[model samples]
Target chain A: MIARLLSAFALAGFSPLLWADALTGDVQRQPLNVSAIAMFVAFVALTLGITYWASKRNTSTSAFYTAGGSITGFQNGLAIAGDYMSAASFLGISALVFTSGYDGLIYSIGFLVGWPIILFLIAERLRNLGKYTFADVASYRLGQTQIRTLSACGSLVVVAFYLIAQMVGAGKLIELLFGLDYHVAVVLVGILMVLYVLFGGMLATTWVQIIKAVLLLSGASFMAIMVLKHVNFDISTLFSEAIKVHPKGEAIMSPGGLVKDPISAFSLGLALMFGTAGLPHILMRFFTVSDAKEARKSVFYATGFIGYFYILTFIIGFGAILLVSTNPDFKDATGALLGGNNMAAVHLANAVGGSVFLGFISAVAFATILAVVSGLTLAGASAVSHDLYASVFRKGRVNDKDEMRVSKITTVALGILAIGLGILFEKQNIAFMVGLAFSIAASCNFPVLLLSMYWKNLTTRGAMIGGWLGLITAVVLMVLGPTIWVQILGHEKAIYPYEYPALFSILIAFAGIWFFSVTDKSKAAAGERALFFPQFVRSQTGLGSSGATAH
Target chain B: MHDLAYKRIEQSPQFKELVAKREKFAWILSAIMLGLYVVFILLIAFQPQLLGARISPDSSVTWGIPMGVGLIVSAFVLTGIYVQRANGEFDRLNQAILDEVKQ
Candidate 1:
């Protein structure tokens, strides 16, 4: 399918840049580059084929939601890694490393530490208990309709904030690769991702993710090795050269004030660590695997792959500083990077292995965006179709065929919503938007999910109220915080000082859950508490749990 | 696997021990990892110079480099240990309890 996509790209091959430049009314010094388009077309075709295959067989809600829970440990591991490493992580994180040096490592560490905690606390238990969503686990012993309602809100809110950042990043990547207008690229990418989920479902999404992961890991390794070779395999020389070229020099090796104060640091730390555990997309990946064992194994493999990838990113960033910084050809007439800092890794690819490799990396980067958006869209679709339509509105009376239709319809709605938001965000300064997504996931979803599993006294009223409180606090504080308030809103002093609201919002959620649950002496609360033991046993042992039935 | 069998297992002494051990172990590991990460954040937020201190006079390598690498390595190491226990001790005891109940 990727090859077919490449052929299509080749068909649109000539004068693509000329047309784009004409529309933008800007002429470029560089000529039209067909190789990059070829590589991008090539990569996407593979996923299109995977989507075709996954769509043909999957007709039921189970298959649509969790690939009928048949994905093996290793494949699921790659998919998890694929889902976690968004195009932002590929380009934006690398760009952070390229610009701020050690601050980037701090960011990567915040992401890496979350995986072990997921393995230790979540993976197995989450897999055993929940058939489709983590909301399943949270609602198992509580009021199903209310809990699912609360969590669906939480999930969709996360998907929206996260989807905006992803859409922007995807637009940027496609613009770089295909030379299409940014809005045009965003729509194309959005439509393509929707198709992947709308037809292919989880199975298609999973394979696309797996393919992207392999491509990314191999692409990064090739670049990193070539980088090391340039310095004659001497690590110290690479660091020393980086220090020389980087404007910040020794300061770049330190924190460099990217994480200004204590509250912000703590909140950012909490958001990054716990946020991974809360993300509906990440949580939903566990359902794709058959059992608890495969679930944990997938986490293990994902942790290793992600950890290794971050280390490579660290190298790639510094490597860019050493090579791309000094090279005049990579610079614009104004003497800055050609496409700003995020292009550092792409420039590094061109520097190390010439245009072919640059095309290869760019294609992989575009594929990375498509794969991630598909996963996010599927999670959003499931939140609507399964959690809302089947469980809430229909009260679980809906059959598989109708539920599958809801999912497909939701995918198209979300795709259009994403494109609309993508265009609207074009003029917005959403630098903190990614943090807001993480903040919401950490504050709202994490606290509810964790307390619901660990604390038996958690009533439905508590979960619902606490989750909304966390959600409200995160959104409000993020809006009032310095990034948006001072910068975007044109305000003087901000109401909230910290960049991240997770530390405080999380506390609010926990306190609310505790206060509400403890004070409730009602019969419903008693019944909810009584249900916890059965839920706990099923979560642990898989005894009488919802085992996967092949569709 | 009937509800009675599950209820019996849940009420058993061995099952109680397994639950206690696993949760305790997970909490401890989580605490350790979280604690280390918090310390790193503290150092970044407060004692920047300490993290900025050069590891050796001769080289450009700073404390943060090895520290960052060590933290990444630690994430992998901790995961390895958990997987080891899950595959070995935890799974074994879990199977034993299930087999005992079945018998």
Candidate 2:
């Protein structure tokens, strides 16, 4: 699942640290048997049908930006879950377990722990404040031009890196599932994602996500149930069987020294915990609801779905260890996995239920990639149009029609950029790419957004300077760190020792924000400070908040 | 109407109490979760053997399985607690505060 989700991040997780199968052996396979391709085509047809239906019904900026703010809590929850349980979670985690064992379990838990915090601290307040992009929240009372510029840069950067990773993952998955060329698969993903956003907008995107989420959860449940049935439905039997088949035996059941030191572990934890809160794609979901209460409810349901899904990944991972490792048909001539071990979960579907189930899981994985990329595209386009164009260039005076038109243009541009980068990064280790995205999100966006909500003295200059610093620090450290520095760039030793830099970069942001804001004696700073009261009240209680105003 | 509502809610003791209580509860839950996760991570970094230790003398199941499961379950339970409080106690308090202001 992680292979398919995290490193399947391959946009969901670009974490190379966890992806052993992603590293070596059979990098490509001949193809999935024919049933998989047929099922995938059917899934695409269904999404295109949804796009055609949604395009007519949604005609205004409000519809394009937020689906008229009418999505129900349960549906949004499903969409959020769909948005999250990417191909990375399905393939990556299973592959990790297939190779390393219990290490996959720790990764899954870290990914989940962020949700309760989002529910408690940010979700309701965000729903109350933002109109479309999360940048709407940050620039509410600050220097609109400066803040939006910084936020657009931050959002675009995160989305670009993440989109590339997902596209690459999509390429790999399509090649395995549909017998397509890698470049063709990437272009197909890019073009389809653009069509979803350009035509159907948020309404289509949300429904696609909802459908994908349902399919993914049901597929995971079917696989887990099938896996358990083999062991008489006893978890102990499953784990023991996995241990016996695994070469590492009992050692696979514990932490395999991945969190070797406190600093690295703490930094990684900070990235995962705060990164989700900062992710532009995730934050923009709040605006698709009517009120703060609905937003809060969305989080509640999302927490349940996401938490449940992670637990399923653990079951599926251990199941792969037990089932996939022992099966000869899934193995290669050299006894290695046929299409890389990241195919473990997909292969397990065939092992448990045969080719038909394999076809089903493969389709679900393809759907997962489509749903996530569409979400990313919408968020990126909003940062370009709503934040950069409407808010900054036109000073929020751009009409609804004009803004939506610009967003569509931005979507096509972003889609092209994503395809190009996907091809370039194909040979690169993308596992750390997701981690880099999270680090910037945690450092740059999270701090600025949180402080804007809570701190009274937060000035525009402070936020811009601090945010850019955070952004630069994260990028510089990422480039010089062990992953990119030593491994990717072929340096002998890393200038930055750790893989994650959120801990240091977050402090830099806070310090820059605090130092500049507190020292400012200018009239604008005082005015900005005064504006925080009304902003605070509105954020807390939704007093005088804008309605969707779409229809 | 909205400005008047904000002024009234800001002044009312009920609103004050609600805000304080909600904020305090949220921070506490967050703190507890952070503590639990930090402890787990610390154990992994400092004493992996503890998580590696078997659940019992005979079982192949290690302590990490339950601990990992427990952490996952802990997130679900904590979310459930938050939802229950939000839907029941917090909502009731919030409604009363708003109603008082509306009157």
- Give model 2's docking category: acceptable
Off by over 4 Å in 2: A1-16, A19-26, A259-265, A486-488, A548-551, B1-5, B99-103
Task: Name the TM-score of candidate 2.
Answer: 0.93
Q: What residue pairs clash in candidate 1, if any at all?
A: A1-A45, A1-A46, A2-A45, A2-A46, A6-A41
Q: Which stretches of model 1 miss by more than 4 angstroms?
A: A1-32, A483-493, B42-47
Best by TM-score: 2
Per-residue accuracy of model 2 over B4-98 as CA lDDT, tens digit each: 67766777787778778888988998887778876776666566789888888777788988998798788778877887787678778877776
Binned by DockQ into CAPRI classes (incorrect, acceptable, medium, high), candidate 1 is: acceptable
DockQ per candidate, 2 decimals? 0.49, 0.46
Candidate 2 residue A168 Cα shift, in angstroms, is 1.5
DockQ of 2: 0.46
Model 1 chain B worst lDDT window (10 residues): B38-47
lDDT, candidate 2, at A207: 95
- Return the lDDT, model 2, position A219: 91
